[model samples]
Target: MNRHLLYAALDAAERGWAVLPLRPGDKRPALHGEDVCPGIGDCAGGHRKWEERATIDPDRIHRAWGDLPFNVGIATGPSGLVVVDLDMPKRKSSTDTPNGVTTFTALCERAGQAVPATRTVRTASGGVHLYFTAPSGVRLCNTAGRLGKRIDTRAWGGYIVAPGSLTPMGAYAVVNDLPPAPLPEWLSARLTARQASRALMTAPSAVRASRYAAAGLNAETASVRHAPEGERNATLLRAARALGRFIAWGDLPREQVEEALQWAGEQAGLSPRSCEATIRSGLNWSIARNGQRRVA
Candidate 1:
């Protein structure tokens, strides 16, 4: 019902930014939307496929904001935008920034480059969101401090709470008037490396996935490999246990280990939620057991 917010959403959409509505003052979607979310978050928008319904049409935007005051959510990936979210320190110190700044600074140093001044947003939490144009064929995933502690990337599958959105805490506001700059090659390489690492780590399982069909393995292996709902968690946990042992010995990145387990789970038809929870629980148990053994 707030015309100001409505116009803000419309203006963003006009600039080819795919937009969606968020619950008033909250980060979650305003409604149960389509399975369009590429952003990885712990809780689903409405606990299910919420981003699928995000849109750029002014008419749909109107309908969304007509009922209650809503926050503007910009879909990053769909619009070819990537945002570097930097959680700046609350205490104003020229040299003091969150770990993200340090990480980014190190990255720039290694790459012989400096961070570009791009379309920037000042978040309610006193953080900054640096917008960039995503490169073609780059599978940029939403990360929580993966790039650097407290630094994250929101790309083709992620969304950013837009400026002019208000929360009880504060509001998001645009500080820079520039358009999103092209993603620097160095940063692109880092994001691409993440995808590459995932793919490489899962390559063996992917091959096994192919073997599961046609020339499939015997019953026990097949059952574990291609798990169904009831047996899914146990099967994945067993696998995660192995991965955790490997990881404990410095044999793998936990992310890739997770991908390997999910790769098998999907082959067996487990949902995303099922895959995540099973892997998390299994990995924790594995780590704990390993720790106890060392202590003993």
Candidate 2:
């Protein structure tokens, strides 16, 4: 690896945000060793391996740059960084290279929208890491997982592709400075409207599961109860719709659910319509039983 390039990347990263360097073998560099510094490490000396060497002063960087835009890190090579969307279905064996690359590209495109400044760095695994400068205060969640399952990206020990992490590969550093398009103002508004509609229509359905559970009915019993005609059909339809909505928007934080619903409503150009009260009630009950708070 090019030590000079690594130093330069660390220096550039220090100019904006703090960086945590990962040695070739270390996994949890931050948690391990005696060294509490962000940049330097002593992995070669086992006894003194974790001794803190030095740390980049965030205050000093801020004073020098006057409010830098992002935080970043550098990896020795492409293998150092890995990309996983955690949205894709997992395979029983072998890696899904095509699908993985597609998802990675999509994430890069999305990041490009928020931070116009982006650079692509190659990984040792022959994959690419898309680097971008994240805007202030925007943090990413659920990043270390497969496109659908729990894919741990930390195994590679490179930069994360989320909003807060910087994109760096091997000796090369990707810098994104161009401004991307802003999200539409009406998006959140539309989601709010849809949420309101769903709230009203699904009110009754929300409590259905709770009602069954209250009556000492297990899942099997509840299924039998809904086997009848008329009300049963409506109940099934409501359940399906509610589940679909959840699947479509469940990844968003609960706080953002209302806004997302409103946005969906606007994009579809449809008036918000609530699902049946039975469905809402059943969903509520299910959520409660699962020890989860309902977002919509």
Q: Backbone collision count in every prediction?
A: 6, 47
Off by over 4 Å in 1: 33-48, 88-97, 203-282, 290-296
Q: Assess candidate 1 and give its lDDT.
A: 0.69
Q: Write the per-residue lDDT of candidate 1 for residues 1-296, one digit (tens) a residue.
A: 48989988998898898888888889766654224433444234443333445678888888878878899999887778889988765456556544566678787787789878889888888778899988987667565455776676777556888999998769999999798899988788887876566455424333223332212212223455666435666877777775565455444556656665654564454543466678888888877776532442
Instruction: Determine the backbone clash count of candidate 2.
Output: 47
TM-score of 1: 0.69
TM-score of each: 0.69, 0.32
Candidate 1: 10-residue stretch with minimal lDDT: 212-221
Candidate 2 lDDT tens digits, 1-296: 23332444355454442344433322223224333323333344442321132235544324322333233343211222222222233355447544444654464465452322234443333344443333233222112222212222221123332222223332323334333222222322332343354334322233223342223212222442334322443433344334333323332222232323322222221211222233334445444454444567
Model 1 residue 109 CA deviation in Å: 2.6
